[model samples]
Target: MSDKPYQDKAVIVTGASSGIGRALALRLADQGAWITLAARDAARLAVLAEECRQRGGKAIAVPTGVTGEAQCKALIERAVAEFGRLDVLINNAGIGATGLLEELPDLTLFKRVMDVNFYGVVYCTYYAVKHLKQTQGRIVNISSLGGKSPLPYNSNYNASKYAVHGFSDSVRMELAQAGVSVTLICPYWVVTEFHERLMDKDGTPRGPQGRAIYSEKTMTADQCAATTLKAAARRKREVLMGPGWLTVWLRIIAPGLVDKITIEMVLKPLVRRAEKTQSKE
Candidate 1:
């Protein structure tokens, strides 16, 4: 808990059923913030809400799929109705897409990724803005390092995060005048269920690439959550986790060098490992 406890402050955390959202929700609850846990998984959300309650904060579960405008609006309304007012909106709900764009047999995967990762944030923020402005609240966007630098073989995911970055940048300025802070959370690679949800063909998980991303070269959700909450409290314009701070600048300093390292560390290796897995399976 911070020195300045949230007490009765209301916070809504989308994707709170699991991963970083769950961790952040718990942290906020410990800081005495009233919490609304939102996700499509009702069972999981209920469990999380209970955990928040155990931490000594008021909490409710709102099972939500952020792709719909109506649902997003309802989520904000419910939070206000439950807690009397809204203080923060954390747009942490997102899906992942890995593997080469050309190899993806289902083109709809592109749209679905954008719908959840990009449009979900847009819908939730659009509805929550009124309450946020009313409270001089904060908008925390859980973006990715893909938003900052190139992520090879994951073009759709990259594009969606880049969209998120653009949207947050525009709104951060717009909301600044209103005293509602907008924060873009750019995490490099988080160990979470997101990669498992990255479907390839017919809802099958993208094989080795997803496995590699989750099991290797990733930061824990708790660490990411702690960083995110601190940033939100500080009303930071943007926060980049892990290697993002160095890597994003490195891209500007040495694009060609970065491209060469990316190919070696990411592109070729992922393709090779995925192909090898396919052969074995």
Candidate 2:
């Protein structure tokens, strides 16, 4: 068996307060890596850190908002100061906003979604790349299947993830000679508190109409996290999770065919139902 890549390494995970981030933190901690947990919720992060310690792994919680560059830099600095070296950076912090592009009132909602989902990854990567290059480390970006295949009523969310896929691909090519590997984890509908936290600029829930659909295909956060860690350790380029791979592959083979099926089978039904619900109200 190959040696565990996480052993004796210092790792950082953003969005570590809950969901996949929390699970990834605990998983890495269990593997004997020193973990730095970054998220906006201090209380939740503290609790997660304690749990990591209980699991016999070193963990430090640093409440962070990945939307800003300074905070992203601080997160990296704190991790390096605590562990003296950084080996992995997991850009897992993200948010989703849903609405028909025409229905969104202004550009504000779109910008906010892009800021967190796209710029957050950019900021974290900007800071983490230097340390990673030094260690010939790894970067695992938490993209989504939506990144590869567009979904209905979530145009903004899909755009951000698509950007992630492109950016990761480009960087992965550049980092190849440096011995640093970049991996993208594309997951489909994981069961997490993500929707609860998803919001528009005014802090209203983004997609109440689609909650039932989300619940149907959702995998547990732990399952996603475990798969992500395994892929990262193996230094794989891309790992697509969930039962949606068939659709994704179909899209790869025939974009127009997949688009027609999605629009006809999924989007039309959803739009019709939404219209009926509105008429009833």
Q: Looking at candidate 1, what is the lDDT of residue 71?
A: 94
For all predictions, the C-alpha RMSD in Å is: 2.2, 2.3
Model 1 spans with C-alpha error above 4 angstroms: 206-218
Model 1 lDDT per residue over 75-192, tens place: 9999999998999999999887676877878788888889989999999999899899999999999998889997798788889999999999999889888999989999877887
TM-score of each: 0.93, 0.92
lDDT of 2 by residue, 16-81 (tens): 998899999888878888999999999999999999989878999999999899999999999999
**lDDT at position 77, candidate 2:** 97
Please list the C-alpha lDDT of all candidates, in the order they appear.
0.87, 0.87
What range of 10 consecutive residues in model 1 has the weakest lDDT sum?
A: 208-217
